[model samples]
Target: MAVHHQASIVPTKAELLAAWVPRQPWAAGADTSSLTKLGSYRFDDPDGEVGMETHVLATADGQVLQVPLTYRGAPRAGAEESLVTTMTHTTLGDRWIYDALHDPVYAAVLASTIATGGHEADLFLSTPDGLVLQPASARVRGSGTAPSAPAAGWSGPRVTVAGTTSRIECDGALLTVLHVLETTTASAAADELVLTGTWLGQDRPVLLAVLR
Candidate 1:
């Protein structure tokens, strides 16, 4: 489960994205000031130390993009290049944010989720009274079945961006995130496992990632 505290954050998520996203290679020339969050989903960290989430945003021009993020209490060593920004939380104090593509925790969870045909974690809102179940705006599912053996170990993800996609590889697992959502893409091979999602307006599943 993913628990969200009912607290305020300085430099709110939208504000942070506005300042940082426009500079990304895939989002270059994007007017992020008007970026609209279409939906989001969460993946749980087994250790429960870091928060993992992926947000889908639509540009002013109607280009859809996916951004995966990880939140930490302190800076991650050797991950300076992936650091997105920092923020102050009313209840959690200072927080560090990094692109999830560079976070090992995210890679491990994503790999496991895909290998096991898993769905996004259940969302829960932490309140003074207790925890309340919250509905997820976006829903995602992996296409693989249980694996017989564990994947080979890899240190972290090596990411490369092309025209409209980002390729991420780690621990012998290759993942391709479609930064720009397109419905006319070629069909996936029968053997390839993929991650697909649906949101409010989009009832048809949209290809989000492919695990090769």
Candidate 2:
């Protein structure tokens, strides 16, 4: 389970996105002015050194995009160019945020979630009343089980299909994430499609990634 805080984050997620997203090739024609969040999901790092989250966003004209992000205590080594920005969390101190593909924590959790047929973790709150369940954000489901999450120290083997870049670990199985997902143009070819969930007012099962 994940514990969320009511603390504020400096610069805010939207501010950072507005500055960095337009430059990405996949977001080339997005209408930033009217961008709306469709929903989001999260993954937990067993070691607890990082935070992993994927937000589904929608453009004014009806384009859906999947953006995965990783939060860390320090800047990712050798990945300066991918840094989205640095922010101070009211409760967690300063944090370094990066596009998920450049962070190993994201790679590991994503691979494991799909391989083990996992789902977005439940959320809870710690208070005087003890642990209380929080309202779920988005609902998601994963499939298959083989390309287990690599060991903690493993960085990643990032890949790109079509125009989307992904972080994957394909040993005995395949677990890959299409960083900038364009559902309208995604190819329906894969060993097994995994990870589907619900969005606000939408119940269609969207394929998050391809697993084999």
Candidate 3:
């Protein structure tokens, strides 16, 4: 059977940082301030539909910060209001926006992409709750299948950490790292991946790892 790859559409590094920096919690400028783009690079998302871009920006203050962004179809359901300034409405009405700290999908893809080709990296798992983690193993399965939906349950490999099974989920620019702590624990219990770097939204060199 032939495998179909989803199309990935991402803004250029310059475009991404131009749009991203202002939305960060630590952004220096006022809402009306202008930003200069420094550089950017792409991270691997198994499913091409969801594109992940890391952007670096230099503010008017001369301070640089890295901001990681996940571009998706449109504003998330209840996030419409938060979309006010963060979203850049597309022709398709597919709003490109900033989902800062807790976006699960982006984190998952970033982790998987970074883990690829690295020794001692086992499996990249995304749980239904949106957690992405690399389990220690010699051979991992489904590394080729990038997650497309948040609700799709875990279907690849069997990883038992501390007697808990885990999965990783990546949606657009968010990555979810999940650990199935116990049957009683909520299915969605997981940690978030936040982007921190020299320049706002820049993930080059080393994607500064911050556990949120």
Candidate 4:
């Protein structure tokens, strides 16, 4: 489960995204004057130290994009390149944000989720009263069976971003995360492990990631 504090966050999520997203290579030449958040989903870090959340946004030009981010209490070593920015959370204090693609914790949880057929984390609000369940803005499921071993020869996650997708390779395993989402009727390949998501208006599952 992911616990959200009921405190103000400086440079709120939308403000941070507005300044960062448009500068990404995939979002080059895109108009974001009216960029609006569509939905978001979260995955729990096994250790519960880092916060993992993926936000989906729609640009004024009708382009839909997904950006995954990780929040840490302190800066991550050797991850300066992936660092988005730093912000102060009224309750939690300072936080260092980085693109999830370069965060090993995210890659590990993502791989485990796909390998064990896991779903998105449950949401809860941390209030003075106690923990309160919150409705998820989006949901996701991995297409994999239980009782499976890790991918063959898996060493660690190596990420590469090109165009509108991020490719993660772990030895022989390959997982592609779609940054730009599109509606399609195509089916997944037999050997591929897929991740699909659904939101309020989008009851139909849409492709989010694929592990091969």
What's the TM-score of each model vs. the native?
A: 0.93, 0.83, 0.42, 0.93
Encode model 3's per-residue lDDT on 99-195: one tens digit a residue.
Answer: 4333445545445542332211222344455535542211111222333423422332122222111223332222332211111212222333332
- Candidate 2 pairs with clashing backbones: 115-145
Q: What is candidate 4's lDDT per residue for 1-212, written digit by digit as tens?
A: 99999889989999999999988887774677768888899999878899999998889998778889999999988889999999999999999999998887887777777778888999999988999999999989888896764655433468887888899887787878888887554267888888888877777788888887
Of candidates 3 and 2, the better by TM-score: 2
lDDT by residue (35-99, candidate 1, tens digit) is 89999999998788999989999988887788899999999999999999999999899999998
Clashes of 4: 0
Candidate 3 ranges beyond 4 A from true positions = 1-23, 28-34, 78-93, 117-207, 210-212
Q: List CA RMSD, all candidates.
A: 1.8, 3.1, 14.4, 1.8
- What C-alpha lDDT values do all the predictions have? 0.83, 0.71, 0.37, 0.85
After superposing candidate 1 on the true structure, give the runs of residues whose Cα lies further than 4 Å from its correct spot: 29-33, 147-150, 183-186
What is the lDDT for 148 in model 4? Answer: 65
Rank ordering of all candidates by lDDT, starting from the highest: 4, 1, 2, 3
Worst 10 residues of 4 by lDDT: 148-157
Best by lDDT: 4
Question: So what's the TM-score on candidate 4?
Answer: 0.93
State how far residue 207 of model 4 sits from its true place (Å): 0.5
Task: Order the candidates by TM-score, highest first.
Answer: 4, 1, 2, 3
Candidate 2, superposed: residue stretches over 4 Å from native: 126-130, 145-154, 159-161, 164-175, 179-190
